[model samples]
Target: MLSILIPTYNYVCVKLVTDLQQQAERLECPYEILVADDASEDAFKRENRKINGIPNCKYIELQENVGRSRIRNILGRLARYDFFLFLDCDGGIVNADFLARYKALLDKADVICGSILHPSKQPSPDVSLRYTYEKHAEHKFTAQKRMQHPYAMFRSFNFLISRSAFQACPFDETIRNYGYEDVMMGLALGRANVSVLHIDNPLMNEDIEKNAVFLHKTEESLRTLYVHRQKLGYCTGVLRLYGILQRMHLIFSILLLYRLLRRVIRRNLLGKRPSLGLFAFYKIGYYCNLAKERK
Candidate 1:
């Protein structure tokens, strides 16, 4: 009745698959778990290969990395069941009833987003940047708040959608990058008037990147947003600020200020005691810099 689809790149997912398999068996539901490895390292590939031993689970390794978007589309096509559960490889099933919760809501809406949860306590100092950002904004991630702007808040990290709905609006494979794939999908679903329901069910996000790695990925996401700004309709607040600054003729001035303080901001972000306020400024400045370069 459900197809659990997980797309991975250089991460071992044997434990995640095994955990879900046991849950499905207990519920006595017809489910299959499919894990797609996107040309990961040989070590990760060997570790994830153990997933095949689990009943109704298959580990498919690709010779080439098709990227974040296409890999999901490929999994959608490979799904045999009516409902698809997409989860990231680096996450864990914290709740024992995660699958059961989704099973009960199979017909509640066209799409159900089970938001992600971060660690309660701060992890290592190296990973504190991401942990701090997520924890600091935990209030906004609750089900009630997310339901207020369902489409805008929709994340592909963990969600369930029917086969017909997924086929109607698949992930845009043209976005061969690290970010905004989920935002694009959410926007498409909203435009199509697809019903989205947000629940309290959250997947435990286990993999928190180090400060340098998180900042690098954040920049990558900004680059993706800049490249597809037109298609994205500039929905983000940063872009909105950019528009406002442009009308005021302050784009270059702000860009100059950003250039002056770029090093200082970088040092803090890479440090143990990073500030989210500064992080926001860095993103805005980086995005503004991208616009300046394009012009």
Candidate 2:
């Protein structure tokens, strides 16, 4: 039996659950759906309640909000089956034969990841551009690759793993925020000599709006990336060099920073305000570090 684990936040979309229901009903093999909700204020819990009678569907509601990585870890521990298929609440199985495909690959891989595609939207060009970038980034790893380069196979949206792999190596809870948790988890699996398989099956993403909350999450993600690098003892030389290039080219830096500031403002006004001034300061520091490295 396969245990399908889904971690949800403040999402109102009922289609995610409905799609899973359809997939579960049609699957020839035995499978269970576990929905771990992170205390959403909206009617997400109530909406989920409607699906309680569905066969093999279990819903869990937390009293408080825990970050996505931690919630998934909790679900991993509670999973009753040896194999686990983790899906984001906004993601759905595009291929009806998804479970079968995973079963075929489980013996050879500790981890199996699928592709994620974007939905069409006409109004928001910025949002569309971001989604396009994300889609291309996630689709880049649809083949077998070395485990040492775990970042190449990382995507939190859709993937399958053996419970044993997680039992031996679990997600880093210190990656308490949203962004780099997937990368850190992948790296951990890689360090443990776990093999990852990337399948061609596409997971369709539901429509998601770009808002303040999403932007805040992005900033948190970058911060988490910084933390991950620190833990891994990876040098920030490349990042520092990029920052130096920005400083040496004033006009280009202004334009680049303007674009970044605009996107940051649009997506994360609620979070710490990222000012052009502070960004310039960061660039100066980055350049100084690069110069020190040269000496």
Candidate 3:
């Protein structure tokens, strides 16, 4: 009745697959798990191939990397069932009743986004930035808070979407980058008048990136947001700032400030306990700089 679709890259999914398989088995429902590797390296590919040995699961590796959006669209096509549960390969199943909870909501929510949590305890210094940001910002609320800004709260990492609803509003493949495709999905759903339902069925985000690596990806995502401003018409604080800069034609001045603080910003963000407020400034400044460079 449900197809669990995961798109992976350079990550082993055996543990995640095993845990999810056990949960699906307990549900005793017709469900299948599909893991699509986006041309990961040979070592990681070999390790992830073990998912095929698990019951109700299959591993398919692509010859070339199709970025994030296309790969997910491909996985959705491979699904045989009506409901598609799109999950990241790095997600850890904390709730044993995860699949059951989603199954219960099938009659009601057409597009439901489950929650994601980092480890309750502290992680290493290298990976602190992601966990800290998630805990402080993303993990703070539930359906009550999210229903207010349904489009803004929508995330692609762990969500259940019907095939019909998904085909109506698929990820924008033109955004050939790492982040905000989910935000774009949210925007599409909003246009379709699909409210993103939130639930307590949470997934543990176990695999955390190094502080430097996470910061780099954050920069990339911000740059993407700048490039696709027309598509992402929503008003984020950063986007508003960008818009204001464009109106004033003051990108060059902001670029100068960003260049002055770039090194200082890097040092702060790359440290063990980076300030998220500073990180916000860092991203805004970086996006301004990137916007200028492109011009």
TM-score of 1: 0.98
Per-model lDDT: 0.92, 0.66, 0.87
lDDT of 2: 0.66
lDDT tens digits, residue span 189-230, model 3 = 989987568877788887888887898798888878887987
lDDT per residue for candidate 1 within 21-62, as digits (tens), equals 999898787889999999999999999999989999999988
Every model: Cα RMSD to truth: 0.8, 6.3, 1.6
| Candidates sorted on lDDT, descending | 1, 3, 2
lDDT of 2 by residue, 180-250 (tens): 67766776776788878776766777754453444445555545545465564442433455455657865
Total backbone collisions for each predicted model: 0, 1, 0
TM-score-wise, the better of 2 and 3 is 3
TM-score of each: 0.98, 0.76, 0.95
Clashing pairs in 2: 179-221
Clashing pairs in 1: none
Highest TM-score: which candidate? 1
- Candidate 2 or 1, higher TM-score: 1
Q: Which of 1 and 3 is the better model by TM-score?
A: 1
- After TM-score superposition, the amount by which residue 174's alpha carbon in candidate 2 deviates from its true location, in angstroms, is 1.3
